[model samples]
Every structure is written in structure tokens, then in C-alpha cells.
Target: MLADTATIVARLTEFLGPDSVVADPVQMGSYLNEPRKRFHEKAAAVALPRSVAEVQALTRFAFEHGVALIPQGGNTGLVGAQVPLRGDEVIVSLARINALREIDAAAGHMTVEAGMILEEAHRIAEAEGAMFPLWIASQGSARIGGVLSSNAGGVNVLAYGNARELCLGVEAVLADGRLYKGLNALKKDNTGYDLKDLLIGAEGTLGIITAATLKIFPLPAVYETAIVNLASPEAALELFYTMRERAGMRLNAFELVPLIGLDMQMRHGMLDKDPTAGPSPWYALIEISQPKGAKGGLLQAGLEAAFEAQLIDNAVVAESLADRTRMWAFREQMSEVQSREGASIKHDVSVPIAAIPRLIAEGSEAAEALVAGIRAVPFGHMGDGNIHFNFSQPVGADGKTFMAGAQPVHDAVYEVVLRLGGSVSAEHGIGQLKTALLKQVKDPVALEMMRAIKQALDPRGILNPGKMLD
Candidate 1:
């Protein structure tokens, strides 16, 4: 039931003017290409709506004319959710609709248009003497809408929580061009069904998010970060418990990084010097925030106890801002460093915090059994139990050959994740990548409710048709 590309582009041009419509396939590359570079389907056209009214007009036209519209933000998403799947849909980029509407530092929230970049949000908060705790690596390019849409969780999720928790409410344009203004900064609203949450992580299937009121916090007085050496995930697990019991909410990040990660970064010249104390099988990037009027050395005290308990053998606390930045770079550059080693298979899976040790040990063993000499690079938010389980190809294996057998490796990891009551897609939403896996692992009742919600909200199936549900 899709119209021809030329007709669709012409109609969209009439609806939003030629400046807003991009019909040329060559010009559409930027909107079509996503982070993974796995999907290649071209969109019919890209529409840049500069205002909420323009977005409504386009959505109404799509609903009435039976056109599929894929809502996109910064297009930095890894799961191909913001990009097209069928090549018949039009991409509705919110880049132009970006505008700040309100700010209330006292209430700990601010409203910004969907098009504004994530890092800009951080700057805005800091200008008001506040802090927006979400800090994803792609903050420079990822926008507020896409971050909320994906319900992104960065290194600080252990402290401030994910995008969903940080978001108080959102303004969205539902299918058929109806505006659903639900923006509110209330701390307690026992309202009927929570619609804000439904659209936040819906991947634009339910509606297109236009703006949101996001939570902000008072800027912390100091951040104490460190790189600690551990023998195994079990040792890291014990250290995590020790630190969490001592620090509580003051603990911001507890990331896991394998010794291989460090070696790769150094060989690729990504790091000038090794951040860890010395050679250990694994390392944990532990960090804590010292609020204003709060005493320092909290992290040092916790690490001291850990060392005494034999949970950690050695550590190096960041003494300067430059040192803290280097320590974090070692953790954030994990994905990029993998490419230097050639072919890699990655999984963003999470398990119950207590079961993390088993998940890593068993998942690594299974991957090795599937392909010998497979270098396991399992690391990530150890405190939150979300490990970026990844593996590089054998020492001299062919890249294409190893990638060809990535499915079994993925199956192996997901098997361990599900067995431990873990999630296959944590932080990153199930874009087109894991739709099949979602259906297989998700509870049947949850699947039914998701389908019912999608059908109810998007009756004609015009908004992101064939995505999440399909």
C-alpha cells in the first residue's frame, strides 16, 4: 500500500515546502546511514519540520494518505531504529524543531525541544548551576528525543538512572497529527495511565516526541575516580559489593574493563600510558561523587577497606581532572578499540547483579567453544550488571569469515543472559537488530500487551509501520 517515491516526495514538498523535503537518493544518505552500517535500505525522502505544527501536518498527511514515516533524531543509534527498514518510508528528522521552551533549576527540571543535542543539554544545566546526570559517549551527536526514545543509560545510570527516569514528561505528536502535550515537572502526580513513559521508549512507534521536561541535579562538588586491578569478574563483583555497601548513591560508576581492552588501547595509541596500577586479568573503573559541603576521600576510604579485605590488590585514584578524563577514556573507548583487533561480535546484555560473574565466565567459555582463540572482551557497567559482552576474532582469522559466524556467538551469549534472567537489549532498545530475539525471549503476555498498545495508539499503522511489533 506504499505510494511511489516521486509522488510521496512531491506531496511532502507541498505539505512542508521544498526546503523541508529532500527527494534525491544521493542527498538522503546522511539520514539513511546509521551507526552500525548494517542496514542499507534508502528512505523515500527526508523531511525536516521546523516546528510542532509542521510535524503535525506531516503526520496527519501520512496517516490520511497511508504513508510510513520513520521518526529520527541525531541518527547515532546503534540498533537501526532511527533509520529506515523498508526503503518505502520517509524519515521525519526533528533536527530543525529544536528550541528550548522552559527552565526551572529550583524544580530540578527543564524542557527542551527534541532536536537539541544531549551535550548541549548538559551545558544548559551547568549554566543554571545544575547537572543533568545522563552522560552517553554520543552526547555530542545524540539528541534529547533519540536518547529518550532509546531510553539510553550511560555510565551514570548506577547513580541518576536511565533516560526514562531522568525524564519527567514529554510532548509528542501522535499518529494522525494530533498533539499529545503531557509535559509536566511534578515530583508526584498520581495520574491515570502513565502516557509519558509509553512514548519515551516506544522508539517512535506510538508517536513522535517533540520535546521533554528532563530532570537536572545540583552540580557535584567533586568526582573521585579510580582504576582498580582485579583477578576476575568474581573479584570485581566482590569489590563492587564492598564499594556499594560503603558509598550507596554517592557511587556513580563501576565499569568493568578486561586487560585485553587496555592492551588494545595502548597498541592503537588511544592511551598515552596504562591507566591501571599494573598487569591484572581485569580492571574496574570505580567512581564516586562528593556533593557540595561533603567530605573528600570517600572513594579512598572505600578502596582501603577493599584492599584490606583482599577484594582488590592495587588501585590508582585520579588526582587531577586530566587523570580522571584518561581513566574514563579507557572505559568509553572499548567499542572503538575492538575494531583495531579486526572482526568483532558484540552483545549489550545485562543480568541480575549477583549473577554477573557466572554470565561472564559461562558466556566467555561458550564463545570460545564456538570459535577457538576467540578473544573475550567482556566489560561495562559492572555495578548495574550490564556488561558490553564483546569478542574479537582469532589472532589471524579472516574478518568476513568470523563475522559470517557471528549469529551462533550471539546465540551463545543471549542463552547465558536469558538463563540468568537477564536482558538481551539493555541501554540500547530493540531496533530492527533484535526484534526477532525480543519475540523469542520476551514474555508472551508482555508481547501481547505491546502489540495491543501499538495497535491502539497507531490504529492505521502509519507511524513506524512494521517496526517494534512487526
Candidate 2:
């Protein structure tokens, strides 16, 4: 039998002090409001667990009482994974558990509590003369647990990989309140199964991540940055190949930005000045890391080669740190600039590197045919083959009406993505937003395997009850 809300709050307050348990709806607003504003379900109460032990205790109580427990971090997830789906569920915010447990610069690893902010982790790594490279726009507010849960990928994915790759191991609270002590700095571990991998990206459906051991790397001495003008996606692809052949793993980022993105930023005054080489149909922001004692200007030489080969129309290499920052700002601000235009339908999808050109061409054409006057804004990590395929509503259209018509546009873009052998979600995982889409697009056998795992691990369905499944 389900406990009354008062009884639940009373018991929680008894276990964890009254300071940690939030019962008032108004006080729970911070935890309830997600980034997208798409999910609007109210949680029964928000519990701020101050330590790993407290997290374990809360999980134990929820497991025994059969109360749904939704694990939340900084509440900055683009998908609704960090928020509640069921109104009756209790949200366990890890914010109070923030702590940097250990840092072993010699071993190239750091142990951080789940609630530690992503930007804080970067600072810790930098202080120790190392780097933790999993970066996202929401790093200021996104926490380590949520970042690992989503397995976030940002601009540096080409060089450093995603959160899963950076994470060495995790300490999670299982469905039964049993602690899984998986954190370690060891580079090699051949266990029976990869449970760490399972929990990292499970989005709290499998377990609650409390702390993790993450890999760190030596900070690069400098970065060679450039923005190259391309005639089309095909030309960008050719240029990407040239850079990959030349720089190999040192090629940190190769981002694609359309002409419209620059126009939007300039029109909205988001940028102080145009950060491009005159006008071009498309542009590719490329960066290469120069390790300590390594030579710089590798990117400039590569661009010179491309120019000589007629692969690129024109290019502007960053002459100073200010120039590099402006170049990156132009790339990162692509998503935010869309809101200035109007209602935008977005899809974070990826295809094979070679197929990215086709994915963009076909997806754009399909979306335009479906919604007349729709502005296609296809851009993102070209090196990793992930494109943030977004569409702004036609000029002078109502945002609500345009958003209401997003279903068909989504189908059209996803169809092309599927045909290109790409993922429906690249960096962003399937939260409540895409659970049905996941069920439809995911293989039946894979779905069955996921269901079996969910059943085996969270048999009571007490952890994140309605997310990533149905």
C-alpha cells in the first residue's frame, strides 16, 4: 500500500533532517523546472541527500515502501531524465551531496561526488594540471551524475570521447538499496559484465549514480582554430577527410554551421560582429590541439593545403585568443539563436561520417517539402557525424501552431536519419520525450533485452518509473 504524502514526508524528515526534506510545492520549484519546459509533472516532495550514505538510505526507504524515487542532479538535462514523470514520485536531488573526494594527478584520475557541477570538475582538473573534457553548454549547472546518465557528448568528442569514455567507473545505489562499489582508477578490469557501462547511460532507470572515478588528461598547450568556408556539405566532407588524414586524433573539433546561423546571430545582435570570412553557403569550425612542446600552426598549414586543392573557398585562422573565442561562440550559439527566429523543431541525430552530407541534404529537403517556408538549420559535430538538425517555423507563423505541427516534421527528418544508418538520438538520450520513438525505432530484440534488464534490476519499478521505457 502507498503511504500518504504526510506520512512519507514525516518518515523522510525523521531519517534525513527536516532541512533536507522539502514538502512544500512552491519550494520544490527549482527541482521541478527542467531545461526544456516540456515535462510539467509535479513531484510529491524533493529530498536533498547530503551524502552517499544519505542517498543509499533514501533509496532503501523508497525501495521498501514501494515509493517511486526519481534521481535528479543539477536539473539541466535537455531531456527530462533528471525530472519526474509520475506526479506521485519523489525527486532525490543530489545537489547537497556535492564533494570532490580525491584527485590523483599522477594516476590521471579523479573521484567526484555525483552532485559536483561539470564546470567545477573542469576547474579541479585544471588546478591539477589536467583536464576533464566532457563539455556541454549547460556545464555551469549540469552535474556529474546527470552528465554520466545522459553520456553527454560535446564539441571535443572527436578527441576525448563522450562521458562514458571519460568515466573510469561509478559507485551507484542499486534498486534494492545495495551499494555497487565500482569506482576505481585502474585502466584495465576484465569483469564478468560491463556493469559500469550499463549504469552510466541507463538514465537512472537501472541505478542511481552517487560518485564516479573519471579519467583526466594533460592540458593541451594551445589549440589551432580556424573557420573555413565551404561550398556545400560535400566540400566540408572532403575537407574533414583531409584534416583527419593530417591531424588524426589531434583534430579535436570539426563543427558545421550554415549561413543562416550567422545571419540569425547578427540580426538578433547575439554576436558583436560577424566572425566569418565574408559570405559563404556553409562554414566548418575546425580545431586541433597542440600538446606541450609541440609545434603550432598545424591547422593553418592544413587549410593552406585545402585552399591549394580548391577544396575550400576561403578560410580565417584565429590570430589571437579573442578570435578563437569568437569562432567557438559562433558555433556554440547555434541552438540559442534559433529561438530568435521562431518556433523550432530540433533533432539531435548522427550518421556515418561519410553519410553526413546525404543526411543533411535529404533531411533538409524533406522538412522543407513538409512545411512550406520552414528554415532548415542543420549543424553540429561533423567529425563525430552528429548533426543538430533543427527547423525554424516559417516567417510570421504563430509559435504554438508551428510547434503543434512538429510531429510530421520530426517524422520526416527521422526517416532520413534512419535511412542514413544514423541514431535517432546522438548526444541526448531517450527521456520521457522520446520513449515512444525509442520503442518504435529500436530493434525488438534490443527492446526486449532492455526490458529484461530493467525488470531484473528494478523489479519493483520504484526507480524512475516511467522513463526510457514507456
Candidate 3:
């Protein structure tokens, strides 16, 4: 039998105290409102568990009652994974559990509670002469659990890889309220199947990640940053290959941006001045790390070679900290500036590195063909073959009307991505947003495996019900 909402609230208050259970609707806005503003379902109640035992206890109650439980962290996920799918679900926000368990710079690892902010993780590592390199625009508010749950990839993915690669181990509460004690700093562990990897990107469907052990690296002595002009994606690809061959692992970041992004930032007064070297059809923001006792100016030399080879038009090397900040601000603000314009259709997809040029060219053409006067704004981690392929609707089109026709636009872009052997979601997981797309594009055997895992871990279908799988 289902437990009454009143009874559930009373029991939860008794166990966790009234201060931890938020029953008021107004006070739950922060947990319900995600970054995209796409999902609008209200949770039954917001539960803030301050310790691992509290989280385990809450899960036990939820599992017994057959009430769906949504695990949330920082509420900064671009997809709706950190929010409730069904209105009757309970949201367990991990914000209050923030704490650093241990940090060993010599050992090259750190253990942190899932609720710790991403930026705070960075600050802690920096204080110990180490670096945790997972970076996103929302790092100021995004937590470690959500970052791991989504397996976030940012600019440095070219060098450091995504969250899953950086994470060494994870400690989570299973669906039946049993604790999975898996945290460790060991580099090699072939004892059995990798359960940590499964839960890290599962988006809370299999388990609730309460804490994790993350890998850290020594801090680089300096960063060589530059904005180089490229005629097109093809030219950018050639320049990337040249830099990769020369700088190797030191080549940290390589991002692509279109001319319209600069125009939009200028019109909105988002940038004090143009950060590019000069006008071009596109720009590539490249950076290289200088380790201690290593030589600098590798980026400048690579740019010079590209210029000699006619691969790039021009380049501007950042001379001061302020200039470097301005260059990065231009790249990081791409997603936020889109809302200022009007309704926008976005896709975060990736293809093989060699196919990126064709993917962008063909996808952009198809979108324009579908909607007359539609502006295409394709940009992002060019080095990793992941492009944030977004399109702004035709000037003066109603936001609702434009969004109503999203099916055809999505079909056009995804068809091209599929043909190029790319993923429908490169960084963002299949939250409520892309579940259907995943079903359509994913392999049959892979889908079966995922379903089996879900069933094995959550037999009652209570954890984040109707998410990724459905």
C-alpha cells in the first residue's frame, strides 16, 4: 500500500527532524528549477540529508514505500537529470553534505563528499599544489556528484578526459539502502567488474553517489593562451593536428567559435572589447600548459607554422592575465548569450575527429533548408569532435511556434550525426530530455544491457523512475 503524503512527511520529520525536511512548495523552488527551465514537475518533498547514514535511511524508507527518489546535486545540470520526473517523487538534495574527507598531494588523490562544489574542489587541490581539471561554466554552483553523474566534459577534455576518467572510485547507496563502499586511491584494481564506472554516469538510476576518490595532477607552472583566426572547420582541423603533433599532452584546450558569437557578445555588451586577433569567418582558442622547468612559446611557434602553411589567417597571444580572462570569458559565455537572442534549438553531439568538418557543414545546411532565415551557431570542443550545434530561430518568429517545430529540426541534425557515427549526447546524459532519442539511436544489444543493469539494481523501479531508461 502507498503511504499517505502526510504520514510520509511525519515519519521523515521524525527520523531526520523538521529542519531537514522541506515541505513548503515555495522553499523547494531551488531544487525544482533546473538550469534549462524545461522540466516543471513539483517534488513531493525536498530532503536534505546531512550524512551518509541519513541518505541510506531515506533510501530505505523510499524503497519500502515504492516512492520514486531523485538524487540532486547543485541543481546545475543542463539536462533534467537532477530534477523530479514524476510529481510524486521525493528529491534528495546533497548540498548540505558538503565536506572534504581527505587530500594527499603526494599520493595524487583526494576524497570528497559528493555535495562539495566543483570550484571548491579546485581551490582545495590548488592549495595543496595539485589540480582537479574538470571544469564547466556552472562550476561555481555545480557539485561533484552531479558532475560525475553527468560525466561532464569541458575544454580540457582534449588533455585530461571527462569526469569518469578522472574519478578513481565512488561510494554510493544502492537502491535497497545498502552502502557500496568502493572508494580507494589505488591505480590498479582488477578484482571484478567496475561498479564505480557504472554508477558514475548512470544519473542516479542505479545508485546514489555520496562520495568519491578523484585523481589529481601536479599544477602546471603557466598557461600559453591564444585566439587564432581560421577560415573554416577544415582549416581548424589541420591546425589542431599540427598543434597535437608538436605539443602532445601539453596542448590542453582547443575550442571553436563562429563569427556570430562575437557579434552577439558585442551587441549585448557582454565583452568589453573584441578578444580575437581580427575579423575572420571563425576563431580557435588554443592553450598549452607549461610544466615546471619546461619551455614556453610552443603555442606561438605552432601559430607561426600554421601561418606559414596558410592554415590560419592570423592570431593574438594573450600577454597578461586580464587578456587571458577576456579570451576565456568569450568561450564560456556561449550558451548563456543564446537566451538573450530568443528561442534556440541546441544539440550536444560528437562525431569522429575526421568527420567533424562534414558534420558541421551538412548539419548546418540541413537546418537552414528546414527553416528559412534560421541562423546556425555551431561551436565547441573541436579537438574532441563534440560540437554544440545550436540554431537560433528566424528573426521575429514566436518562441513557442518555433519550438513547436523542433521535431523536424532535431531529426535533420540527428540523422546527420548518426550517419557520421556520432553520439546523440556527447557530454550531457539522457535525462528526461533525450531518453526517446537514445532509444531510437542506441544499439539494440547495448540497450538490452542497460535495461538489465537497471532491473538488477532497482527491481522496484523506484530510483529516478522514468529517467534515462524510459
Using Cα atoms with residue i matched to residue i, what is each candidate's TM-score against the true structure?
A: 0.99, 0.99, 0.99
Q: Write the per-residue lDDT of candidate 2 for residues 1-470, one digit (tens) a residue.
A: 46688888888899899999999999998898987688898888989888888888988889898999988888988779878887888999888777999998778999999999999999999999999988788899999999999999999999999999999999999988899999998788986798999998899999999999999999899989999999999999999999988998899999999999999999999898888998999999999998899977779878988999899978888889999999999998998889878789999999999999899889989988888899999999999999999999898989999899999999999999998899999999988889999988999999999999999999999989878997
Clashes of 3: 0
Error of 2 at 465 (Å): 1.0
lDDT of each: 0.92, 0.91, 0.92
Tens-digit per-residue lDDT, 56-149, candidate 1:
9999889988899999999999888999898899999999978889988887999999999999999999999899999988999999999999
Candidate 2: residue 163 lDDT (0-100):
95
Model 1 alpha-carbon drift over 4 Å, by segment: none
Residue 418 in candidate 3, Cα distance off native in Å:
0.5
- Candidate 3 residues 209-318, lDDT tens each? 99999999999999999999999999999999999998999999999999999988889999999999888999999999988899888998899899999999789899
- How many pairs of residues collide in each model? 0, 0, 0
lDDT, model 2: 0.91
Q: Give residue 17's error in model 1 in angstroms.
A: 1.6
The per-residue C-alpha lDDT of model 3 at residue 266 equals 89
How many clashing pairs in candidate 2?
Answer: 0
Residue 160 alpha-carbon offset, candidate 1, angstroms: 0.7
